[model samples]
Target: MSKDFYSILGVEKTASDDEIKKAYRKLAHKHHPDKEGGDEAKFKEINGAYQTLSDKQKRQQYDQFGQTFEGANAGGAGGFNFDFGQSNAGGSGSGFEDLFSDLFSQTGFGGSASSQEKVGSDVAVDVEITFEEMALGTEKKVELYKRVLCDKCEGTGAKDKNTKTCETCGGAGKVHKTMRSMFGAIQQVVPCEKCHGKGQIPKEKCSKCGGDGVVRDYQKVNIKIPAGIEDGQTIRATGHGEIPIGGGHAGNLFITIHIKPDQNFKRSGDDIVSKVKISFSQAALGDKIDVGTIEGVIKMKIVAGTQSGDIFKIRNKGINREDRFGRGSHLVEIQVRTPENLSRDQKRLVKKLQEAGL
Candidate 1:
């Protein structure tokens, strides 16, 4: 049975060029073989559908013919001569260097043609740190399992040093196939599954990497955390991820920070809030009291006749700004405690004073 390209990509037949590309990218990322629970067959199917719909002429042909386009290839193999290098190889001054230069510029690969190579998959790890560490930076060493290129095969996945041209695609790395449609014929070129688009086959397979060119091993990485980092923040380390198949590039490592709460102090934006209890006499008569702050214990003065529930601000006693902009003020909420019981002598003295009205 023929597959519906539009339905495969979850898009309409009349979708715009940008819309089609966007849908293809989304599906490709979701169904990529590197991802967990990914289906290789579904990924290839979406790739094939996108390969046809992304081109202007092919899409027009498919719109008119439906599924018969598979028969359009000259040899009925359902392939097309796309000449992906045509744009660069054309003109009198163009050459392989120019072709590679253009490709590298678009793909962010540096001078090396191998820079176009894909990197390995990325891995994510969650870490918990104390609030003090979040306030002040900290370092962590984490152990992770990741794929690394096989040293024996040098990432070629071959035990023997020799390599031969692929027999399936004749070193072209692609197979030509034609599809017959009611409207006409559509030709397509697909990557050879046996050679995996490499257009070459190794003489022997590497036992260490199982012909996959990657081995799973434990790796230790050190992460330096900056001060004032917030909870749930993520930090990325480039090239510290899983190695790609056949030794392309390495993926990134993402570390999510989880900050633990402090028991004594509460954070409010950039400031720190805390409470202090004082005796009723202390509230009535001015006195110096020691309070805990981020820096340390600081002495704060209580004004005479201070009421309960009154707040006192200590300058630069709060949490430091993450950006080092300045320190915040610490607010201390005062609570007054009254005497639960009074002695008989104290009561008698209070009664005598009341009677004298002195």
Candidate 2:
């Protein structure tokens, strides 16, 4: 009886390659033998299903003939020569090797041997920018005291550029091992311990970094903050963190943005809000008044009988919108101020107006 690969992986027949890979990863992690309550049989089953569906040509063949395709390649599921004494998890030698390779490339699955190579650690830093700077994009230069690639060996970790390929794994950076499990013998590919998966070793280690290919030093990194970036938003600076030892990809630098509060303006989504004080006369009659905005102070009209807390908008003067082509509006709130002290003549005029019911 042919195995249903799609059903085993819990994916539809029309599932995309990413969806299949994701399903396989989830199932593989859940059923791994090394973990508590892990099922070796189920892990093997998931690997087999992933092995058949991940390949384009093999998937087409399986869709057409299940596992009984005529003249199917020896490396595929249809041509497996089952040995009851051995693990039936793989069709041929290549299937298990391919499975390990694919799994290792995607994520780390811990084992007796190294499943992943050592990489540099990620670094995070907090950056403070003014509210005006957040409104308009700006760049900041931050000094980081961390590991950087060695200058003497240029990250090769060698003396006078002297190096040789690792003999244990034959420069492949990985080696194959067979282990007995509940299901039977399973072959796995693991990182070579001799060269630490670097594939090469320095004949004489670099004096400055002691073969690590990195040194702790101070470096200034420039981080660009996008326009209208919110507080607590993070910006990733790729390849700017710690450089790996013995030469690998560098890790990333994460910059968290902190905006300084503005005394005159407050942020509300894409718009900015500000309050402007107007005298009672100005509120009672229509007049033009200067209002504060993010760009600058601009003239705004105050209509007759304008009440306190009335809002007016100044278009295109708020934060810059990076996603689209435009700026947000600036909202101005009116505060009407009553006269505190009145002269005798002013009191007499008010008294006369009050008498007339003005």
Top candidate by lDDT: 2
lDDT score for residue 33 of model 1: 61
Write candidate 2's Cα lDDT for 1-358 as tens digits: 6458899999999998778877887798788877789887687677667767876677898899886753353344322322222232233332345445553443322232233465567899999999989887899999998889899999878898788998997786766666554555555666676776778888899999898888999999988788899999999998898876666666789999999998998899888889999998888887999887777778888889999999998899988878867888898999999777999998897788789996
Candidate 1 global TM-score: 0.57
TM for candidate 2 is 0.71
Query: Candidate 1 — which residues are off by over 4 angstroms?
Result: 1-116, 151-154, 160-202, 314-318, 321-324, 339-358
TM-scores of the models, in the given order?
A: 0.57, 0.71
Candidate 1 at 70: error in angstroms?
A: 20
> 1-358, model 1: which lDDT tens digit per residue?
7679999999988898777767877786777665687766786677567767866677788888878874462233333233334442334332223222332232322234323345568889999988667655789998998898788887777786456788997876555445443212433344455565567767888888877778998889999887667789999989899877656668889999998888766667666778888987788787999998877898999998888899998877665555778876788889888656779987786577569982
lDDT of 1: 0.70
The alpha-carbon root-mean-square deviation between model 1 and the true structure, to one decimal in Å, is 10.4
